[model samples]
Target chain A: MSKYLLNKFLYTVDRDPELVERYREDPRGTVAWWEAERANQLLNCHTGEASTWLAFDDPEREALVAHDYVKLFELGAHPFLTLTLFIAAFERDHAEPLGFQKEYALRLQHFSLPYPDIAT
Target chain B: MAELAAVIASTHHPFYYRASTARGEDRPPFADEWVRKITAFRETLTRANPDVLVMVGSDHFHQLWLDNMPQFLIGKAPVYDANWYNEEREFGLPRMVLKGQEDLSGYLLREGLDAGFDLAFSNELRIDHSITCPIITLRPEADLPIVPVYTNIFAPPLPQPKRFVQLGRTIRELIESWPSDQRVAVIGTGHLSLELGGPRQFGPHGPDPEFDQRAVEWIANGDLEGCLSEVTLDSLHAPGNATHGFMDFMLMMGVAGEGAKADYVDTLDLFHTMEAYFTWYPSGGPGLSEERACEPRSEGKGESA
Candidate 1:
């Protein structure tokens, strides 16, 4: 019964603010922010360590981490161990639908969060 | 005599390299020693040169991840190319032969042991780095026939080490059971050490050599738990080991069989990372077996050679 810490971390942060601020750069859109943030956390988790996880980075893979993060949080499993199980479930069409991206976007626009200081 | 011959686990580090180079983005802390080790193996691979290289790596979420990410998968397509970067960005990556071995692919699923590896084999998905780099490495500008083996390492909640190894053994069983006469090679590619993003603590040149050395030693000896044990935050310099994705190497190491074989050897140190570490194994041998005890092994559909 091994559990993924990411799943717990996301579920915990999905509703709580205290945990979200640890990695969040902005407080606005905290909920939605956590989605992408969680992906970043998972993707870049191996920063200074000699890890093979981030051996190669792809912009698109960021999407996979985000999508998979939310999908796992929804299932409420500890991420690391069951993470692949959840991924397998999604691939097999045996899991829940992933539609959180838009909702997260709406939340971001609602609060103008992440301080998107984009140069337009 | 072996049936399927050999199984491989490989990925497209160069495809990722192409993307990273373009954006001028840097994935830091990938110990140079890791790559150094792999590059050395290239020569041996060239010498041993198997008939078909069984590659195990991850996809771009195109064929699977976006829609679904399987813990493990196999490809049955006859051929595939990078339609996105090649056609769109004009990268000029050659289309690779995914091998029209439907019977083998089908047998891997229908007959291979269900040692807990999930399947997501495909015939339509265009290729990605996870499927492309080996072409360049194996032949270096030559098109070599490859049987694609896809796994979801980048995506969330990847399988635990134990299960992933289980999947590797499944790969061994399936290959050992194959009846093909061609000699086979197993390849696993990805980073041995990696750090992501910018303005971060550890960069490409970051030291932290202690962790890197340990990983090299563990992988060389097929000490998975030893590798994982040392794979902690202090070594990673972050909560997660960016190179954790390289676990595929360990999985492939398991399939390659035995310990400390001189397959892929590292030479140059890229920003303190081993550019490569490669190894070669004798052909015609069967995969791992539970001789003395009933060790949890990778199962397959085999009727003996």
Candidate 2:
């Protein structure tokens, strides 16, 4: 359960307009590409100094590819990152203001107090 | 010594820029009232006539990340670029640049460390909506130089809630002891029982209005003992997932000092979350007249204790 890796994916992708559109259009392809090439690249370091030990596990990979925010929440991914990226990708699809956000909440009504531990 | 001009705290709602500036048909029904409340809130700072602002807010993973996050940091640069690509994309916030008071920042860092807080310093920081939103609402001119203080309310392994209050107190003490004549206002922003990216998010009101009411009372009255007694790191979760941001408000309460009732108080019960505004004048302030100083606090929706 590499919550840090999952958060890094969400954080990196959300900041980049191209990555946001790419992941929105092709989740599976983006996840596969990100895992293969970008996963181990240290954010503040040169590519040669990338850490080799960072990689998402199977469930985390599947959750990302599937665009499953609920599964990501269950997996202890940072909800803020997931929600931000999802909104960037999908908010345009909803006509009303905060329509997508309301829907996101409804979908996760099963979660109660003490939601998944998000500590990295 | 610099005069502690005014201590102000508010909820930094990013959407206010777009909502308050929206035009005919595009404007939401709530924008007019929000603007009115904000206009009144702006007057509180304007009356103080502060030269430099010590702005306190938490970084929302914009520049500070979990990989090597600082629990508390002070931006010590000569200039600060405000707003970000994501903030612009999400909140329709305009980009801004504000001058930095590096001397005050240095004073705080050197003195704050000696006071026992391992404060971090950033030379170049592009501040996000947490700092900029107040600029838009209060000092729309964005003319005053500022010192930006970032707190780790977003990330885990966060400092305890009391630590925020302690830092606020230290900030107030340090600002008073600085050997400058410039009037300084310490402004901070935080949330009240907010839930983002969770099951209770984006509701008609904040995730927990009951908690918001109690939290507002604790702040407006400067009841740090009451606030500290009940609010723990573990206990905050019951109010809302994002309620940790309320610690910034607690931090402001510490700056205001114990039993210091706010001279000005107002709240707007907006959609999704409640907006609160508070201001305390330490020395009766400069521009505030005797009659104006005695005016009743505006009870927008919530009452101040």
Candidate 3:
């Protein structure tokens, strides 16, 4: 329903690993923060049951969401987000930089949105 | 039955953003050139105006995985929430709801199986750049629906060339049998040579110039057997891992029929990628006669016409 909120939450979690650790350390508090900030407004879209995550203990939450941030981004092989690939793009060395990232920025320009500020 | 309108094969690399890297009198990186090419390609698609687009692309280990990935999978959802598949929110793709062809997808599953294609079906299927990149760049009207076909060309145990060709033929047959007057277009997304993060990372790795040129020759001439037989897994992966793109091209060739003629072919020599774009047309009316011409003209009868 709230796709924007879902994208923000996934982007936030994907953009930073520390936030994921925090989410693992305190599922309730972390989720509360996302909720307070409206980042998890569409929490159910990301997680099947929002309350399930709320009820999850720290270890359980960690196992569910933070165990392997990068690998977990995928349902099976396809990542939940394209940013996952964009981030992985830099792992390789090429004469050109951010090949996919640059393309993504151009695609964003079509939407009239500003380019992402996250440093790769 | 839906009439096939056009067939397109493209290098689906993320090159839309690297305009600043152009070199020479055109600046450091060749940005303007690509912009013009992409713009022209997008315009070409708009002009074609197919009612539905059947997108054939390789999976990026995103939706389908090695553990349970099928050789070919079809998306059957009437409307899909594509957000589950896209991570890059900045691409400005309309991730909320991607339209699908439920009835046509159903026909494809049932008929595709009958045609010897054990197509995996998913209603909750998600897609990655392989499908999105072309759609967003082409900027098709909002009304156009798409049928997503995911092929396991990236991972090992890829389908043999013959099998991929057969799948394409089966799709063609299914589309022809459908009674809808829908104008259908088939878009295959991938590259000739691209080795991502492989041994050639710092330099030229996966995309092979020779391979790219040869492939263009085969497709341009509509040499079906040449395409199917000449380019193998080794030849594709020789330059780098990115050459798996040929698989999509194979599927496109199949659907286009053996008699399809390459109307236009362009290559972009970007870093780590030798991307190419090709638009094909059936020599005349779905290339049925062209396909017949390719046959021994008398294979079963024992005489060459």
**Best candidate, lDDT-wise?**
2
- Model 1 earns a TM-score of 0.56
Candidate 3's TM-score on the B chain: 0.83
Interface C-alpha RMSD, model 2: 0.7
Q: What tens-digit string does per-residue lDDT give for candidate 2 at B93-141?
A: 9999999999999999999999999999999999999999999999999
lDDT of 1 by residue, B1-305 (tens): 23333333343444323432332233333424334333433445655556676777766434453224567777776665543432122233554444444556666776543645557667665666655666555545445566667766655556665555666667777677776666666666655665321111133342334445555555545565665555532333232234556667767766755453432334234442334454534342333232212211111111111
Off by over 4 Å in 2: B287-289, B292-305
Show where candidate 3 strays beyond 4 Å. A1-120, B17-28, B83-86, B89-96, B140-142, B202-206, B283-305
- Residue-level lDDT of model 3, residues B120-192, one tens digit each, is 9898777777887677557534467889998887655677877777788788878878889997878888767
Q: Is the docking of candidate 3 incorrect, acceptable, medium or high quality?
A: incorrect
Question: Listing candidates in order, what is each one's chain A TM-score?
Answer: 0.22, 0.97, 0.33
Alpha-carbon deviation at B133 in model 1, angstroms: 1.2
For model 3 chain B, the run of ten residues with the poorest summed lDDT: B296-305
Provide the TM-score for each candidate, comma-separated. Answer: 0.56, 0.98, 0.66
